[model samples]
Structure formats: structure tokens, C-alpha cells
Target: MAINQKSFDQVTGALSSLDRNPQAVRQRVVALEKVLERAFTVPGTQYKVGLDAIVGLVPVVGDWVTGAMSAYLIWEARNLGMSKWQLARMSGNAVFDTAVGMVPFAGDLFDFVFKSNSRNLRIIKAHLDKHHPSTVIIEGEKL
Candidate 1:
């Protein structure tokens, strides 16, 4: 079957660029989630880890680099109206991840499991769902 690749691409592009609205924040969150937590598959295992873990292998410098990238999620969450406590929780996660990530080989393993970006994304999504309900829509129903 010959498919119209251009049309498909256009549709996907539109769907993926939902950053115009407040709830569209999920788009960026999802992007960060992919980069920080779910970018690759480990051979012979069902686990996935992303650039955050890969970069954390570079000793001290790597932890800083990945920590900076992870900060973007907290920034976005703040802009999306996450509360102070929520922000603190998110910050705590990032701090812990970065601090532990400073360890030698164990840091890489920590990064694989302690996905701060994903955790922060969940908190942001929940806050948006509860307080700014209009911002989120799910399964064709308004949240």
C-alpha cells in the first residue's frame, strides 16, 4: 500500500507541536522524559535508559551536564503552575539524582533507576490535572 508520507508527517508534526496551550506543556515534558529516561533499550534486557545515564558516566562533569538538562523540566513545571511544595519535591529529586550520580560506577546505575525528570513530569501532570484541569485533555475527554 502506498501511503502519503507527506500527509502523515504533517499530521504528526501538528500533533507533536502542542506547545501553544498551557496543557501542551506535556509535549516538552514527554520530550524530556525520552531524553532523560527512555531513550534506549539495553541489550538482553527490557530496561531503557537515556542520555542522562550515558552522560553520568563521564565522572564529575557528566553529572553537571545532565543535571542542567534535567533542570529544564522543573523550569517548565513552574511555568505550568506547579505549587511551591511540588517544585520543592521536584528539586529534591533532581538534587538527589545529581548528588548520587556523582558516584563512580554506581551513579550510572542510580541514573537508570532514579529518573528525576520522569518523576517531576508526573507531579507536574498531576498538578495540572487537579488545579488547571482545562489545560489537560485525555482520551477525547477533558480532564
Candidate 2:
């Protein structure tokens, strides 16, 4: 079985779009990418979408948005019936993002790298693979 105990793939779901099937990964990446675009010129860019302009710079609001997004990932995992340990690991990504994202500018920096949406996507992917290795992630499945 390609099943791995670790939720690595689930945590990295944002990139799943780059995979053969792009549904799950593509949606999450696109949405988060929008957030990054509006918030910064570039996520890590010093002059462009740097972490400074990111909403993560805002203490309460930024964290709320980030948390909400993270919860979506967890909700997906629940629908997939992921194991508790897997869900916890997925939550860890969200928790880390919320906690560190609370920082002033530093949180934005964390968001750039941590990428809660991407992390959640990864968790979802991992859960899918672990639970249903034969499954193919098609766009319609999202509907």
C-alpha cells in the first residue's frame, strides 16, 4: 500500500493541483493565491507581495481568516473520515499558522512559508490517498 502513516501529502495539498488531477489541489491553491495577491505584491518578495502587506499583519482579523480556511481543510478531512491522528496532524498545521500568524510582520512571513491553505490541501490529499488509494481527485468531486 502507498499508505503512509504521516499526513505529509495531506499537509501539502495546495500543490496537488500540479498533480495529474488538479481538482483538490488547484482550488485551494487558487484561493490562497488570491489572498496572497491581494495582501502582498509577492508572498516573500521584499518590494512586492512581501509579508508586510499581508493581512496576517493584522492581529485579530488575519488570524480569523486563516483559522477559517484551516477549518475548511479539517472539515474536508472529517468528511473523508480521516483518522484522529491524521486530523490532529492536519490541525497542527492550522494551529501553527494561527499561532505564528498572530505575530505582527513575522506572522506574514510565517504565512508565506507555512501557507495554511496549502498545508490543508496536503492533509486532504494525504487522507484521500491513505483512505482511498484507488480514488482519483476529479474537479467534479469537489461539487
Candidate 3:
């Protein structure tokens, strides 16, 4: 099998352990989203930011590094069997974030506001809720 397929199967298999504990999967997703996009709040402002934005301050290399981190969320969504369209949209968000994020000052500012990982996580949650309801965790209870 292709390496990508093999790695995907491994991820799917690993995630299957949480089939009877959907709350765990939900927790994982939520934690990852926070880490990637909402780890902190700006003082005296309603805005929040995370490590993705922090790392993105290193000029050219920073955006690429964070882009790879963002890809992990999409990879997990694929393991959950999200549709191609949803996956494509998620990829686009990351790509857009990364591309514009390479623009120095403006990119750092954009990263603070764009928050692509959080957006992608929301999309993943919506897809799971609507199409894979079995995997959704609702109010500490597995739906």
C-alpha cells in the first residue's frame, strides 16, 4: 500500500478505539483547536491567538512550520471520514492562511484574526454532527 494510505489506516485504526467513547475524540479535537488557534487572549481586547500565530512571527520559515501543524487537523478530519468537499474547504483555509501569512507584518496580523485551525475545527465538528452523528459528543455524553 502507499505510504499515505498506510499512515491513514493507522490513524483511523487508532481513532477507532474511541468509538465507544466519543467524548474522548471530541476532547482531543477541542484541545487541538485551542492549541492551534485560541491558546491566549490579547490584553484589553476580545481577540485570541495561539501557538500557530506565535510561531508565525519567525518570518518566512514560521508560516511554513505552522502550515504543517495546521495540516494535522485536516489529516485527522480525513481519518474521521469527512467528505472530500469539506476536506477541500479545510485545505483551502490553511493554504490561504499560509500564503498570506508569508507577507511579514500583515501576515502576523492576519493570523491573529483569521484563525484557520479554529475555523477548520468548527467545520469538522459540524460535519461530524450532521453526517457522523454517532461520533459527536454532546454535553459530556456520546451522541
Candidate 4:
């Protein structure tokens, strides 16, 4: 039991450390953006779709859920000490997505193309690259 407890504690400690690490935050935000905006490719089409498009098929609740997820990215940005203007821009993107996403069918179509999370991810990446250069990820290179 003590061994098991020790392992669990180690895992939780690592996760908590990740919470404070800018690189971990960048990785998390990038993964979330991929999940929200480009999870899978559409059959017979080059276009990709993610939860933002799929879950957005539902009426009100889906938009709320995805909007909350988008807000998480903004929260992480704030934790990274991002400027107010950047935070406001990210918030505006999320709000616009949520607002337009409330519409019935048109909103579903909009979600497939708009990709607000991707936009916000770009913003976060820019900030991280400029301020926390060590967090910048090089594609195809192991860290």
C-alpha cells in the first residue's frame, strides 16, 4: 500500500509541476486546440473536424461546453502573464464562437470553418514563442 501511495503521489506531483510549467501549458493548449478544431479528417474531403463541429450539432448545451473549453485556453494564457489586449482578443474569439454557435443549423456549419480555438492557440503560441522561447515546439523533433 505504501508503494502504491508513493507512486500516486509522484504522479500527482509531476502533474502539479506541469501546471506551473509554461512548456507544459503550451503542450496542453496545443493538444486542446487540435482536439477542438482538428481531431479527424472528414471522409472523402480534405477538411478536418473536431469536437467544436461535432458537439456543436446539439442546440444550446454543446456550444456552452465548447465555449467553456475555449475559456480554459484563455485562463491558461492569463496564467502565462499574457497582456490584457491579447486576453481580450482571445475572449472575443471565444465569445463570438459561442454567440454564433447558438444558432441552429447555420451555426453547425460555421463551427466547421471558423475554428476560434485554433485562432486562440495561435495567439498563445505567439506569446509563448516571444516571451517563453524555451516552450516553442519544433515539429518532428523530440524534446
Quote each prediction's TM-score.
Answer: 0.78, 0.57, 0.77, 0.86
Candidate 1 vs candidate 4: the TM-score winner is 4
Task: After the best TM-score superposition of candidate 1, give how far the Cα of residue 81 lies from its true spot, in angstroms.
Answer: 2.1
| Candidates, ranked, lDDT | 4, 1, 3, 2
RMSD to truth, every model: 9.4, 12.6, 4.6, 5.6
* Top candidate (lDDT): 4
What TM-score would you give candidate 4 relative to the actual structure?
0.86
Please provide, for model 3 over 79-136, each residue's C-alpha lDDT reduced to its tens digit, 9 standing for 90 to 100: 7778899999999999999999999899999988898888898998897778667777
lDDT of 1 by residue, 5-43 (tens): 998999989956656456567767877888888899999
Q: Extract clashing residue pairs from model 3.
A: none
Alpha carbon lDDT at 92, candidate 1: 96
Q: Positional deviation of 85 in candidate 1, in angstroms?
A: 0.5
Q: Which ten residues in a row have the lowest lDDT in candidate 1?
A: 15-24
lDDT of each: 0.84, 0.61, 0.83, 0.91
Name every residue pair that clashes in candidate 4.
none
Candidate 1 regions exceeding 4 Å error are 1-20, 134-143
The TM-score between candidate 2 and the true structure equals 0.57
Best by TM-score: 4
Model 4 poorest ten-residue lDDT run:
134-143
